[model samples]
Target chain A: MDEFASIHHWTGARQSAEWQQRRGVVLGIGDDTAIVDVGLAEEGVAAPKRMLLAVDTMVETVHFNDATMREEDIGYKALAANVSDIAAMGGVPLHALVSVSVPRAWGPERMRRLYDGLYACAERYGVAVIGGDTTSSPEHLVIAVTVTGTVEAALALRRSSAMPGDAVFVTGAVGMAAAGLHALLAQRVDGAAEAAHPIIVQAHRRPAPSVRAGRLLAAHGLGCHALNDVSDGLASEAWEIAEASGVRVVLHETELPRSGSMAAYASETGMDPLEWMLYGGEDYALLGTIDKTSVIAALELFRKEGIPFFLIGEIEAGDAAVELVRARAAGVSHSGKQEKRVQLAKRGYNHFKR
Target chain B: MDEFASIHHWTGARQSAEWQQRRGVVLGIGDDTAIVDVGLAEEGVAAPKRMLLAVDTMVETVHFNDATMREEDIGYKALAANVSDIAAMGGVPLHALVSVSVPRAWGPERMRRLYDGLYACAERYGVAVIGGDTTSSPEHLVIAVTVTGTVEAALALRRSSAMPGDAVFVTGAVGMAAAGLHALLAQRVDGAAEAAHPIIVQAHRRPAPSVRAGRLLAAHGLGCHALNDVSDGLASEAWEIAEASGVRVVLHETELPRSGSMAAYASETGMDPLEWMLYGGEDYALLGTIDKTSVIAALELFRKEGIPFFLIGEIEAGDAAVELVRARAAGVSHSGKQEKRVQLAKRGYNHFKR
Candidate 1:
């Protein structure tokens, strides 16, 4: 699939979690400033509220590779990467502080363009640049963006919320960026490729976040069990969810959604496209789980909102490992449907690996 | 003096700006999250507040000299640098995301130590590590930390508040860090210097922040006219206040408090002791201006809180500049009782040149 199309599918995986009113959190993550009601001052009545804070840094080449990515896309992807955490907790994005470490060769013009792209992404997601620190670096350009967000008291979403049997669903498709990367690297193009295929390159560079989806999910009282962004590939993310929630995940191969381009690229690369779908990184999509009974309604809501989604898998009982089921009615290895089994890697991405 | 001392003295130049409340900010820099009040629902308000954001970074040799600095210091510095910005704005700090670019030679132990330091700093500051992206670089280890801080309203301290005739003051001593560096780099007295001057070195390496000072300054109704932290030398900071507030600064040289070791180091280096006093950076003390009438009351309040401060200068109406007056002597370099004109270039530490 093209990059935007890939993004469409990738975005389908995210879901927001339920919120609770906790102490010291006047606001959680859905606004410009997170109001934290501090219980520090008074014994019976009034206590002065205090706050604590932080941000994120995602760089191109250093943090991500743009072997075939677009500048605008890079900008969006960088911002979205940070915002995903805010969305996970239903925080409203506030102001942003940015610092860019750019190579001297890129100079001011390229820097301006990069900022324009960043601004575009921030605007699309409804955020502002309040303050930042900028300096020169030796090599490739780096962008560090910090976002402030707020939520109502105790309404913050955390990774430690998933429970066993919570149905797992993804907002969009998987492995689109990885697929795009493979296609770009292979240099194979045909009449079959759409004009918007290059946009996919942009998608790989600039992934817009689903801030609206996150807000809606948090507000609707949907039974989302947990939340996480898919920056480190689906399988890796699955493991994180499982570990955090202390539940096992059984991902059916039949339910996996892979774009045609990703499939073709995987075929050419002598690797399972499913593996790329499962373990290729940098999609920036959100993955969430909800009760089985609430899935249809949530899906319907997303459809009405023009947000794509899929009920890809279910949360399982027992076992901490992420189990992949490969059921077969034919000789082909389809993405997620499975009644049979196939050999799979026991691990996902590891920093120590060469 | 060691690395810590230099960092401490360097930071002394900055002061917290008077807090002013603007619309749409729910929580800000001192908390776990910067909350922004926004209208998400269509029927909620006129304009929904946007996202909260912040950015901070670590340079190769400047912030951390890998040769002598430990991995933990590097990590702590990276995180602390960002957290300071949040504190400056009186916002609550929240989840922090980090990005690092390191030379291949840096190992897993180093990286783990860096994370350990970051976590320790976070724990001390009450922040959580949400997400980040990492990659390799051919040169220096670069770390960018973005912290999201929330504010109750869109209120922040700015550089534009010093009124003419304000009493300029500083919290904590100045020039010690620079003095420590001069001593350490010059290889002064062996054991005596090592034991006696260790505090200066510590001040340079692991400079503790004035977060409490900043918050106190913001909350107190002391009529603070302008504020900034001393990072660049005190003279440079004074210039910032003068320029931002449309005034000139007249400092009493004798009143510029230099720590004991800092003073000794300067004498040993054969460097003009006064030069180091005015120019050495990384003090981290706050240089703030208060209304003339508020001076005594402010000091009284500080006395109650047991916070130390010194009345160092006075804001005057003129071109933005810093004038130095030597005590009990008559040697004219400029006008009036000013014995010497503290030129911007000649005063304070210049990162690029030094």
Candidate 2:
């Protein structure tokens, strides 16, 4: 039997109604190719626009172990990571093409549930699952999703445009997803039972992208010169921004946001919470730098939505290097009337290193 | 060590200059998302246009076994399958996003060589390698590629538009790739060398998409009703057209083209060459229906380019079913009995059955 039998019927039968709401699609699915009509109206007339494209892949064991993670979670995370890429560019995702290779052991019900999860997340973002290819794999499942979105020419932010004197900010707490993964691996799920301080479990299973915050920054037309999402830890993303912009990114270690669940987990395990915040991946949090003048306005916009926005550092004129330091807080003066701090080297995940 | 280091550098390095030749790409690789400028000149003025999106995944064992297939060939086949989808739509492919997951055991140099093959193919097809995600796989390698293309509204052909009286045709020979694969598996590759026939070891390794052929068909604008690529054999694709168009597809089995390699191999192995012709997969040949009057013109156009196109079937007004029978040759007016033929059941590759 064809292993994709279930996926074909599931996606074909279930998604037809969902696809009707999607505008601008010339041919949605069940063809050699899926077509999307991308013309948008401007001043009562149609104007040509640009499209945003990105794809992400998640493999079994590398991303989620089949034993512990639910099939739906795998589907959700696969689409979420790609959505985060769009969020990093300050754009709205309009369509998605998902290609899956799986073992024959997976049945139709499981595939349907997986699509349910994928469709649920896509529905939340109003993205249409336009088309994809499905086939059998040798051993494990692989989910790769490609997303297309539209961006205003002027509002598109590049990672290389950060200017000196720009204030660095992050939309939400980082390292929580990493801590959740650690907890899952260590079987520490019991200790954080009913913990509301940090939505750690939710963080790893379904991390939300800072799409609205990113859009607000882009629309401000302030110095929204740089933007990126923290997928492979804060340090790795910070390095990306620094190298792309060719500017020095200096961060105050004490100012890095640590979630309550992460702090509690770190204390219980005798691990440093800051390390997780710096090196942990899959946070899906937006990190960017804007001119100092727009900082207050950006904060105001996020505050209205009850989203956490924190100022962590600044961009300085220098070569592409990032420095981490423990800066003294601006408070009471010591008896010696002096301030001292310690600097540490940065550490983050490198795909090249085993 | 990471298996994708060279892919990162290779795609990032070689594509910058190549992307300049590709029109409509605003931003290329090395970013959160790639942006494409899809505005077209309509009536000498710019008008918004539609974008075609498709994805295909090639998995180890399922598509290729590492012991027999070279790494570069694996990469070539992965991207070729996706390009064929775009070609099937009569569109020009603009951008591609590749997501690959490989075992950590694979070294960086091999990955680099694999990317070299991918880029070579992409350059030949005028496709820009935009952004994609790379991660480690739990076991085997999985390559998923997404392609973006643009189609003129009037030039786009659908698989469900075949008229009842339209004649059926196929571009080039079918089942050659399958024959090459069979030779490779049976270790008969050397024996076939003596025959000045087309085993075409390169056919399966680097199957070229019928992009030019499809474009010419669409541009003719001469009653080209339905269009589809012969990826899953002639019978399967013919059935797809029959089902989609709500018409009966009748094919003359005797008219199906079989290359010399296929005929020789079938005789050697005591296998039916006709079976391979009807059920062989991955030929990447174009199959569609056009008005009877335009068939000669279409054949002439292909012949001018030294390409082979054959008419072996026709569409009839009936329920969605396909019938295959031994058809008589032209100019045979015998006084004897004329009904000496057989009808065979349709069979092709199906994913579910073992």
Each prediction's DockQ? 0.22, 0.20
Give, for candidate 2 chain A, the lowest lDDT window spanning 10 residues: A1-10
Could you tell me the C-alpha RMSD of candidate 2 in Å?
11.2
Q: Candidate 1 lDDT, tens digit per residue, B1-354?
A: 222232223222221222112324443332222345443323323321222446567777545554334677777767776666555554456546666765677765577677777766766776655445455565667788776544434244445577778888888888776666655555444444446678776666555655666656666466776767676678877876776677888888778877877766666667776666677666667778888988898888878887777899888888877787666565555455536544454244644346
What is the TM-score of chain A, computed separately for every candidate? 0.76, 0.79
The TM-score of predicted model 2 comes to: 0.82
Which residue runs of candidate 1 sit more than 4 Å off their true CA positions?
A1-55, A64-72, A152-157, A185-196, A264-271, A327-338, A342-346, A349-354, B1-55, B79-104, B112-139, B146-157, B186-196, B303-306, B326-343, B346-353
lDDT of 2 at A85: 78
lDDT, candidate 2, at A309: 87
Candidate 1 is scored at a TM of 0.78
All candidates: CA RMSD (Å): 8.5, 11.2
Considering chain A alone, what is the TM-score of candidate 1?
Answer: 0.76
Q: Compared with the true structure, what per-residue lDDT tens digits does model 1 show for residues A189-265?
A: 53222343554444455665666767666664677767666766788777777766677777778788667766665
The candidate that achieves the highest lDDT relative to the unseen native structure: 2
Give each candidate's fraction of reference contacts reproduced. 0.17, 0.41
* Model 2: per-residue Cα lDDT over A1-354, one tens digit each: 111232233223322333332333333322111233345322245343346778878777777774335777777888888888778877777667778786777665576667767867776776656566777777788889988766555566667778899999888899888777766666645435325423676788787877787677768455677888888788877877887789988777767888877888789889878877888888988888989988888888779878888889899998887777555644433555433333334455432231
